[model samples]
Target: MSMPIESMLLAVSLNFLVFSVSFDDMIGQSFASLVPTMAAVESAIGLAIFVITFRVRGTIVVESINCIQG
Candidate 1:
Protein backbone atom coordinates (compact mmCIF):
# COMPACT_ATOMS: atom_id res chain seq x y z
CA MET A 1 0.00 0.00 0.00
CA SER A 2 1.10 3.54 -0.65
CA MET A 3 0.35 6.78 1.15
CA PRO A 4 -0.68 10.04 -0.46
CA ILE A 5 1.96 12.67 -1.09
CA GLU A 6 -0.01 15.26 0.80
CA SER A 7 0.14 13.28 4.04
CA MET A 8 3.83 12.56 3.67
CA LEU A 9 4.62 16.20 3.03
CA LEU A 10 2.49 17.26 5.95
CA ALA A 11 4.32 14.94 8.31
CA VAL A 12 7.70 16.18 7.19
CA SER A 13 6.64 19.78 7.39
CA LEU A 14 5.34 19.36 10.92
CA ASN A 15 8.53 17.76 12.11
CA PHE A 16 10.64 20.42 10.48
CA LEU A 17 8.58 23.16 12.09
CA VAL A 18 9.51 21.90 15.54
CA PHE A 19 13.15 21.44 14.57
CA SER A 20 13.36 24.90 13.08
CA VAL A 21 12.16 26.50 16.31
CA SER A 22 14.98 24.97 18.32
CA PHE A 23 17.51 25.54 15.56
CA ASP A 24 16.59 29.21 15.28
CA ASP A 25 16.79 29.64 19.03
CA MET A 26 20.27 28.12 19.03
CA ILE A 27 21.34 30.47 16.27
CA GLY A 28 19.95 33.43 18.17
CA GLN A 29 21.99 32.53 21.24
CA SER A 30 25.19 31.63 19.38
CA PHE A 31 25.47 34.36 16.77
CA ALA A 32 24.89 38.09 16.27
CA SER A 33 21.46 39.40 15.26
CA LEU A 34 22.40 39.79 11.59
CA VAL A 35 22.81 36.01 11.17
CA PRO A 36 19.07 35.42 11.33
CA THR A 37 18.57 38.07 8.64
CA MET A 38 20.65 35.99 6.25
CA ALA A 39 18.51 32.94 6.97
CA ALA A 40 15.39 34.99 6.25
CA VAL A 41 16.82 36.11 2.90
CA GLU A 42 17.57 32.51 1.99
CA SER A 43 14.03 31.51 2.95
CA ALA A 44 12.67 34.20 0.65
CA ILE A 45 14.81 32.93 -2.21
CA GLY A 46 13.45 29.44 -1.59
CA LEU A 47 9.91 30.79 -1.62
CA ALA A 48 10.54 32.43 -4.98
CA ILE A 49 11.85 29.16 -6.41
CA PHE A 50 8.76 27.37 -5.12
CA VAL A 51 6.48 29.91 -6.74
CA ILE A 52 8.34 29.65 -10.06
CA THR A 53 8.19 25.86 -9.98
CA PHE A 54 4.46 25.90 -9.23
CA ARG A 55 3.85 28.35 -12.05
CA VAL A 56 5.72 26.12 -14.49
CA ARG A 57 4.38 22.71 -13.41
CA GLY A 58 1.25 23.64 -11.51
CA THR A 59 2.56 21.51 -8.65
CA ILE A 60 5.27 21.71 -6.02
CA VAL A 61 6.87 18.41 -7.04
CA VAL A 62 7.02 16.78 -10.47
CA GLU A 63 3.77 15.10 -11.47
CA SER A 64 5.65 12.10 -12.82
CA ILE A 65 7.06 11.44 -9.37
CA ASN A 66 3.56 11.25 -7.89
CA CYS A 67 2.69 8.59 -10.46
CA ILE A 68 5.14 6.21 -8.82
CA GLN A 69 3.83 4.16 -5.87
CA GLY A 70 5.93 3.20 -2.92
Candidate 2:
Protein backbone atom coordinates (compact mmCIF):
# COMPACT_ATOMS: atom_id res chain seq x y z
CA MET A 1 0.00 0.00 0.00
CA SER A 2 2.08 2.84 1.32
CA MET A 3 5.32 1.03 0.48
CA PRO A 4 4.98 1.34 -3.28
CA ILE A 5 3.89 4.95 -3.03
CA GLU A 6 6.80 5.78 -0.74
CA SER A 7 9.19 3.96 -3.05
CA MET A 8 7.88 5.94 -5.97
CA LEU A 9 8.35 9.21 -4.11
CA LEU A 10 11.87 8.26 -3.05
CA ALA A 11 12.82 7.43 -6.60
CA VAL A 12 11.29 10.63 -7.93
CA SER A 13 12.87 12.78 -5.26
CA LEU A 14 16.35 11.41 -5.91
CA ASN A 15 15.98 11.86 -9.65
CA PHE A 16 14.57 15.37 -9.21
CA LEU A 17 17.49 16.38 -7.01
CA VAL A 18 19.98 14.97 -9.46
CA PHE A 19 18.24 16.58 -12.42
CA SER A 20 18.03 19.92 -10.64
CA VAL A 21 21.79 20.03 -10.29
CA SER A 22 22.45 19.68 -14.03
CA PHE A 23 19.35 21.53 -15.21
CA ASP A 24 21.06 24.88 -14.89
CA ASP A 25 23.86 23.70 -17.15
CA MET A 26 21.66 22.02 -19.76
CA ILE A 27 18.88 24.58 -19.90
CA GLY A 28 19.39 28.31 -19.92
CA GLN A 29 16.37 28.83 -17.65
CA SER A 30 16.74 28.98 -13.89
CA PHE A 31 15.78 25.92 -11.82
CA ALA A 32 12.93 27.85 -10.25
CA SER A 33 11.57 28.74 -13.68
CA LEU A 34 11.57 25.09 -14.82
CA VAL A 35 10.05 23.70 -11.62
CA PRO A 36 6.54 23.31 -13.02
CA THR A 37 7.54 21.33 -16.09
CA MET A 38 9.98 19.22 -14.16
CA ALA A 39 7.45 18.43 -11.44
CA ALA A 40 4.74 17.47 -13.95
CA VAL A 41 6.94 15.12 -15.94
CA GLU A 42 8.49 13.55 -12.86
CA SER A 43 5.15 13.04 -11.14
CA ALA A 44 3.66 11.23 -14.12
CA ILE A 45 6.71 9.06 -14.55
CA GLY A 46 6.87 8.30 -10.84
CA LEU A 47 3.23 7.22 -10.69
CA ALA A 48 3.67 5.00 -13.71
CA ILE A 49 6.66 3.39 -12.05
CA PHE A 50 4.67 2.80 -8.88
CA VAL A 51 1.82 1.19 -10.79
CA ILE A 52 4.10 -1.15 -12.69
CA THR A 53 5.99 -2.14 -9.56
CA PHE A 54 2.83 -2.69 -7.57
CA ARG A 55 1.33 -4.81 -10.33
CA VAL A 56 4.41 -6.96 -10.41
CA ARG A 57 5.27 -7.11 -6.71
CA GLY A 58 1.85 -6.71 -5.11
CA THR A 59 2.60 -5.68 -1.54
CA ILE A 60 5.86 -7.57 -1.19
CA VAL A 61 6.41 -6.69 2.46
CA VAL A 62 4.04 -9.40 3.65
CA GLU A 63 5.97 -12.07 1.81
CA SER A 64 9.23 -10.80 3.16
CA ILE A 65 7.88 -10.79 6.66
CA ASN A 66 6.66 -14.36 6.29
CA CYS A 67 10.04 -15.46 5.03
CA ILE A 68 11.78 -13.72 7.92
CA GLN A 69 9.45 -15.18 10.54
CA GLY A 70 9.73 -18.68 9.09
Candidate 3:
Protein backbone atom coordinates (compact mmCIF):
# COMPACT_ATOMS: atom_id res chain seq x y z
CA MET A 1 0.00 0.00 0.00
CA SER A 2 2.60 2.48 1.14
CA MET A 3 5.04 1.35 -1.53
CA PRO A 4 2.81 2.58 -4.31
CA ILE A 5 1.96 5.75 -2.48
CA GLU A 6 5.63 6.49 -1.82
CA SER A 7 6.55 5.78 -5.40
CA MET A 8 3.83 8.08 -6.66
CA LEU A 9 4.96 10.80 -4.30
CA LEU A 10 8.55 10.44 -5.45
CA ALA A 11 7.52 10.72 -9.08
CA VAL A 12 5.33 13.73 -8.47
CA SER A 13 7.92 15.56 -6.44
CA LEU A 14 10.63 14.89 -8.99
CA ASN A 15 8.45 16.14 -11.80
CA PHE A 16 7.55 19.27 -9.93
CA LEU A 17 11.17 19.98 -9.06
CA VAL A 18 12.28 19.52 -12.63
CA PHE A 19 9.50 21.67 -14.02
CA SER A 20 10.11 24.39 -11.51
CA VAL A 21 13.82 24.47 -12.26
CA SER A 22 13.31 24.80 -15.97
CA PHE A 23 10.59 27.37 -15.58
CA ASP A 24 12.73 29.41 -13.27
CA ASP A 25 15.76 29.33 -15.57
CA MET A 26 13.69 30.17 -18.62
CA ILE A 27 12.40 33.21 -16.82
CA GLY A 28 16.02 34.26 -16.02
CA GLN A 29 15.73 33.82 -12.29
CA SER A 30 17.15 31.54 -9.64
CA PHE A 31 15.10 28.37 -9.28
CA ALA A 32 14.66 28.82 -5.58
CA SER A 33 14.07 32.55 -5.83
CA LEU A 34 10.52 32.29 -7.04
CA VAL A 35 9.12 29.56 -4.80
CA PRO A 36 11.69 28.06 -2.48
CA THR A 37 10.26 29.78 0.57
CA MET A 38 6.72 28.79 -0.20
CA ALA A 39 7.85 25.37 -1.33
CA ALA A 40 9.57 24.76 1.96
CA VAL A 41 6.48 25.75 3.88
CA GLU A 42 4.27 23.53 1.78
CA SER A 43 6.69 20.62 1.98
CA ALA A 44 6.67 20.80 5.77
CA ILE A 45 2.90 20.85 5.88
CA GLY A 46 2.58 17.95 3.48
CA LEU A 47 5.19 15.93 5.37
CA ALA A 48 3.38 16.49 8.63
CA ILE A 49 0.10 15.38 7.15
CA PHE A 50 1.70 12.31 5.60
CA VAL A 51 3.38 11.33 8.84
CA ILE A 52 0.24 11.68 10.91
CA THR A 53 -1.91 9.78 8.49
CA PHE A 54 0.65 7.04 7.98
CA ARG A 55 1.07 6.56 11.70
CA VAL A 56 -2.65 6.41 12.31
CA ARG A 57 -3.30 4.03 9.46
CA GLY A 58 -0.36 1.85 10.41
CA THR A 59 -1.60 1.63 13.96
CA ILE A 60 -5.05 0.65 12.80
CA VAL A 61 -3.65 -2.03 10.52
CA VAL A 62 -1.44 -3.44 13.25
CA GLU A 63 -4.26 -3.49 15.72
CA SER A 64 -6.53 -5.23 13.29
CA ILE A 65 -4.01 -7.94 12.53
CA ASN A 66 -3.24 -8.46 16.18
CA CYS A 67 -6.89 -8.72 17.00
CA ILE A 68 -7.44 -11.28 14.29
CA GLN A 69 -4.49 -13.38 15.38
CA GLY A 70 -5.29 -13.26 19.07
Candidate 4:
Protein backbone atom coordinates (compact mmCIF):
# COMPACT_ATOMS: atom_id res chain seq x y z
CA MET A 1 0.00 0.00 0.00
CA SER A 2 1.17 3.49 -0.84
CA MET A 3 1.02 6.08 1.89
CA PRO A 4 0.47 9.78 1.43
CA ILE A 5 3.64 11.85 1.45
CA GLU A 6 2.49 14.15 4.25
CA SER A 7 1.47 11.21 6.43
CA MET A 8 4.78 9.46 5.81
CA LEU A 9 6.77 12.54 6.74
CA LEU A 10 4.74 13.09 9.88
CA ALA A 11 5.17 9.49 10.91
CA VAL A 12 8.91 9.66 10.33
CA SER A 13 9.26 12.86 12.34
CA LEU A 14 7.25 11.47 15.23
CA ASN A 15 9.20 8.23 15.20
CA PHE A 16 12.45 10.15 15.31
CA LEU A 17 11.28 12.28 18.20
CA VAL A 18 10.10 9.30 20.21
CA PHE A 19 13.24 7.27 19.61
CA SER A 20 15.57 10.17 20.40
CA VAL A 21 13.79 10.88 23.63
CA SER A 22 13.80 7.22 24.60
CA PHE A 23 17.46 6.85 23.73
CA ASP A 24 18.36 9.89 25.77
CA ASP A 25 16.51 8.54 28.75
CA MET A 26 17.93 5.05 28.41
CA ILE A 27 21.54 5.95 27.57
CA GLY A 28 21.86 8.98 29.86
CA GLN A 29 23.54 10.80 26.98
CA SER A 30 23.59 14.51 26.25
CA PHE A 31 20.60 15.52 24.17
CA ALA A 32 22.41 18.24 22.28
CA SER A 33 25.08 15.93 20.92
CA LEU A 34 22.79 13.01 20.30
CA VAL A 35 19.94 14.82 18.59
CA PRO A 36 21.90 16.15 15.63
CA THR A 37 23.45 12.83 14.73
CA MET A 38 20.23 10.99 15.26
CA ALA A 39 18.24 13.53 13.30
CA ALA A 40 20.63 13.41 10.38
CA VAL A 41 20.43 9.66 10.10
CA GLU A 42 16.65 9.57 10.55
CA SER A 43 16.13 12.33 8.01
CA ALA A 44 18.34 10.61 5.45
CA ILE A 45 16.47 7.35 5.85
CA GLY A 46 13.07 9.06 5.78
CA LEU A 47 13.98 10.97 2.63
CA ALA A 48 15.11 7.82 0.91
CA ILE A 49 11.87 6.10 1.78
CA PHE A 50 9.87 9.08 0.64
CA VAL A 51 11.59 9.09 -2.72
CA ILE A 52 11.08 5.39 -3.18
CA THR A 53 7.44 5.53 -2.13
CA PHE A 54 6.83 8.47 -4.41
CA ARG A 55 8.04 6.41 -7.36
CA VAL A 56 6.06 3.34 -6.46
CA ARG A 57 2.45 2.74 -7.46
CA GLY A 58 -0.63 1.08 -5.95
CA THR A 59 -2.19 1.35 -2.56
CA ILE A 60 -1.97 -1.69 -0.34
CA VAL A 61 -5.31 -3.39 0.18
CA VAL A 62 -5.92 -5.59 3.14
CA GLU A 63 -8.15 -8.59 2.79
CA SER A 64 -10.09 -7.73 5.92
CA ILE A 65 -11.89 -4.46 6.46
CA ASN A 66 -13.94 -5.59 9.48
CA CYS A 67 -11.42 -4.25 11.97
CA ILE A 68 -11.61 -0.74 10.55
CA GLN A 69 -15.37 -0.49 10.84
CA GLY A 70 -15.55 0.24 14.53
Query: Number of the top candidate by lDDT?
Result: 2
User: Comparing candidate 1 with candidate 4, which one achieves the higher lDDT?
Assistant: 1
- The whole-model lDDT of each prediction reads 0.57, 0.59, 0.56, 0.54
Q: Which 10-residue window in model 4 sums to the lowest lDDT?
A: 57-66
- Candidate 1 lDDT for residue 43: 68
- Cα RMSDs of all predictions? 10.2, 9.2, 8.1, 10.7
Q: How many backbone overlaps does candidate 4 show? A: 1
Over 4 Å off, model 1: 1-31, 62-70
A best-first ranking of the candidates according to their TM-score comes to: 1, 3, 2, 4
Name the 10 consecutive residues with the lowest summed lDDT in model 2. Answer: 24-33
lDDT per residue (tens digit) for residues 27-47 in model 1 = 433334344465567667778
Q: After superposition, how far is residue 63 of candidate 3 from its true place, in Å?
A: 12
Off by over 4 Å in 2: 1-33, 60-70
Ranked candidates (lDDT, high to low): 2, 1, 3, 4
- Tens-place lDDT per residue, model 3, 1-70, is 4456556555665666677677764433343343445556666887786677567666534445454431
Badly placed stretches (over 4 Å) of model 4 are 1-31, 58-70
For model 3, the local distance difference test gives 0.56
lDDT of 3 at 27: 38
> What are the per-residue Cα lDDT tens digits for candidate 2 across 1-70?
5456556655766566677677645333343355556566767887886676567667645554354331
Model 3 error, position 58 (Å): 16
C-alpha lDDT (0 to 100) for residue 60 of candidate 3: 36
